[model samples]
Target: MATFEEQLKALESVVERLERGDLPLEEALKLFEQGVGLSDGCKKELEAAEGRVQVLLQNRNGTRRVEDLDLEA
Candidate 1:
């Protein structure tokens, strides 16, 4: 599995490539597909981090309990 930092770097590169605006139609579509995959990867990375933070904050006892993630009324 790619680390969070690695996924972030890949996401950044994808954005840069898209921003360059020089790709031909076929190549641009390919880059767009890759960007979508990278976007999902980034989202998964963030969700994983949020889960870990929840675990640490809640001090779960060998089981995950997510109440710690919500502190608003």
Candidate 2:
């Protein structure tokens, strides 16, 4: 299985190919389906990473403090 970065790069390539507007309808649809799957995979990986980070922050320095992740900056 590809790492998160590799999967993201594949997804970007799929988007580029679809955006070129030169493939047959069936081929384009296939790429679109693959892109959706990749998108979902990336989302799952990211959510898991976020949960890991939250765990790490709570356990750091033996403090056992839980901090909300400020995803919105």
Best by lDDT: 2
By summed lDDT, which 10 consecutive residues of candidate 1 come out lowest? 60-69
**lDDT tens digits, residue span 11-33, model 2:** 99999999999999999999999
Q: For candidate 2, list the clashing residue pairs, or say none.
A: none
Q: What is the C-alpha lDDT of each candidate?
A: 0.81, 0.90
lDDT of 1 by residue, 1-73 (tens): 8877887788889789889999898998898898888889889888888977877766536765666445575
Q: After best superposition, candidate 2 residue 1: deviation in angstroms?
A: 1.5
Task: Score candidate 2 by TM-score against the native.
Answer: 0.78
